[model samples]
Target chain A: MADAALRRTPLHDLHAGLGARMGGFAGYDLPLSYPAGVMAEHLHTRAAAGLFDVSHMGQVILRGERAAEALEALVPVDVLGLAEGRQRYALFTNEAGGIEDDLMVANRGDHLLLVVNAARKEADLELLRAGLPESVTVEPLDRALLALQGPGSEAALAALAPGVAGMRFMDVATVTLEGTEAWVSRSGYTGEDGFEISISEKAAVRVAEALLAQEGVAPAGLGARDSLRLEAGLCLHGHDIDAATTPAEAGLGWAIQKVRRTGGDRAGGFPGANRILRELAEGSERRRVGIRPEGRAPMREGVELYDSADALAPVGRITSGGFGPSVGAPVAMGLVPAALSEPGTRLHAELRGRRLPVTVAALPFIPSNFKR
Target chain B: MKYTEEHEWLRPEGDLVVVGITSHASTQLGDVVYVELPEVGTVVTQGDEIVVIESVKAASDITAPLDGEIVEINEAIADEPGKVNEDPTGDGWFFKIRPTDMSQLDAFMDEDAYEAMTG
Candidate 1:
């Protein structure tokens, strides 16, 4: 999309002032990297704290007495059971057992706050509006989201909102920062211990500046966020999990709480429950697996995977692949037959007309360090 | 030293020509992680992609600047691709080539012209 047509986040001027290399993403002109470059930004996030402008993501508020129960109709997650101030990962599944979009559902006492993917936010809003009862109001907020991630993120954020230091992973609370009310969540896309702060568009720039000014905190961009999530084995919404992928096939059955499973208290009321439940009971034919390319060359998305060096047809294809700056090697994720999904299973990726050896490794090349 | 539209710099060293990307190109391709260089003695024609570079952002190719045989390759870059970003025009040279027609270098841009084009 043209830069003129692309949307700008509240922190767009702040990013430009920081010398960010802006690029178009999900209809927004956002920073792909700063002057420090993607590699340095990624490494800095892993070692210290990196602030990210994720305001491109959609934020919506679901209000009503039965908000949680109403939401359970769309996602397989047990939203009704989610406690106040806690958040759970959820997905919007279609009737065909395919994923519509993955989102985070946070219970904010009287209502539920839904954070959806940027590309699917509009459609997700329509889905929620049409699917839920009219009594439940769906409000899309014009807010800017910032992710403060890494080992030192707590210290950096605690400096501004001292209450943030006491929260654990997946906890959400309201905190005052820079004289404005900020919705803070002790969660993030990166596997580091961090927080995702939701601020009003008016206060976004000041809040971002305050966070960036903190010691051990640097401004990272979309490029570093992607690499960090890949190393953490977190799936990118469109790339790793998409409209054609089922939760079971994507290895996301864990997100579907047992309460929504076949024999649980809630049973299956969500869309695509039949197929999703079947896949959960009887294993999926294809499973998402981690792939480690043999050499330095990165096996990017769409690279076909084969069973052997001389295989005629591809057994699978890489969904997401890139260099893991933290791991110091190339890592990837792909979907293959269940028989070939085990760690240590050998696979070959066709890169530039050559089939190179790759190994089926465990997910999350780097273990997550979330504060429990 | 001479430069190509693709941002490569070619400096004649005796009969062989040293080829590497300019700092402008390296800065554009931030933090190169891997480089795939052709083996020594490999023959290539002009515009043939002879080197594959993988940066943190994306993958790109360095095409052969002139019809020639690669006399020597830079293994240091293959092992440590960050050199391409650290010193793109000097120690980061990709290969030494014995050009079939050394006059082909005449068509490239000099420092001032290349700077003007990039600028």
Candidate 2:
């Protein structure tokens, strides 16, 4: 999409002021880099702190008495038993075992809050609207989301909102920032200790400015955010898990809690539960695994993976691949045959017609530093 | 002598002309971490991709400026890819190509023309 056609977030002007290298992504003309660039931004985030404007992400509220039970009918997770102020990673599956979208469901006391992918917001909402019962009311929050991610994040946030320090990883609290009400979650996608602050569009600029003015906080664009997540072994929705991929095959079987799986209290009520449960018992044929190419030439997405140098034995394809700055090498994740998905298994990723040696390593090229 | 729309620069250096991405191109690319150069003695035509540069974000191809046979590639860049961003037109030059037809250099835009076009 052209820049003019793309939607602008509340903090678009702030990014423009900071001279962000904007690109068209997820139907938005968001920043791809800053003046400091991606490498510096990525390293800074891991070492110190990085604040990202994730306002383009969708914030939704599922209301009513049957909210949790109604949500369970659409997703494969056990939302019905979710404790207040806690969040769980969940996915909405189709009837054929493919994922519509992977999301974050938080039981925010009064309502079940969902954070869906920015690109798939409308479709996800449509599914939620059409799939749920009449008692449930779907509300879209016009909010700006900012992520304060890194080792120094807690300190920076504590300086402003002291209550944020007490929250554990995956904990959600509606805290006040200088008296401005905001929903602060002790969670982030960067695999670092940080918080995702959800504030109204009216208060977005104030909160962002405050965070940026703090020490050890630099503005990171989507480029650094991507490399951070990739190194953390986190999957980008459309690229890694999509309508063609099931949670079991995508290595996201963990997202489905035991309460919704076989032999649990609320078992087998959601879409594709049969196929997913069966895959959970008997593993899927193709598994999403991490790929580590052993050279300077970074293997990119759509690169074919072969078992031999002769290109005879085809295994899989790269979904997302990039140079992991922190890891100091190229790291990629792709869907490959379950037989060859074991760690330390030597595989060949066909790059430029040459079979480049790639090793099947564990997901997350770097260890996650989340505040558990 | 001239620049391509793809942001590659071509300048005659004795019998062999040097080819590299322009400084503007490097700035836009940001923090080049790796470079893939073709082997010496390879034959390439103008507009044919000759080098691949991977940054922290994405990979981009550097096209040949003129129909030429590859004489040399910058080995220093292969070891220290950041040189491409530091001195794009000098030490960061991607390759030295012996152009088959010297007249092709006239087709590209000169420095003043290229700057105005990009600006």
Identify the candidate with maximal TM-score: 1
What are the candidates' individual DockQ scores? 0.89, 0.84
lDDT minimum window of 10 residues, candidate 2 chain A: A1-10
Identify the candidate with maximal DockQ.
Answer: 1
Give candidate 1's whole-model lDDT.
0.94
Report the Cα interface RMSD of each model, rounded to 1 decimal: 0.6, 1.0
lDDT of each: 0.94, 0.91
Tens-place lDDT per residue, model 1, A1-372, is 238989999998898899889999999999999999999999999999999999999999999889899899999999988999999999999998899999999999988999999999999999999999989999999999999999999999999999999999999999999999999999999899999999999999999999998999999999999999999888998899998999999999999988999889998998899999999999999999999999999888999999999999999999998899999999999999999999999999999988899999998899999999
Model 2 C-alpha lDDT per residue in residues A240-317, reported as the tens digit of each score: 889999988899989888988898888888889899999998999999999999997777789999987886867898
Summed over model 2, clashes come to: 0
Model 2 residue A238 CA deviation in Å: 1.3
Screening candidate 1 with a backbone cut-off below 3 angstroms (N, C-alpha, C), the clashing residue pairs are none
**DockQ of candidate 2 relative to the true structure:** 0.84
Give fnat of each prediction, in order: 0.84, 0.95
Q: Which parts of model 2 have CA positions greater than 4 angstroms off? A: none
Error of 1 at B96 (Å): 0.8
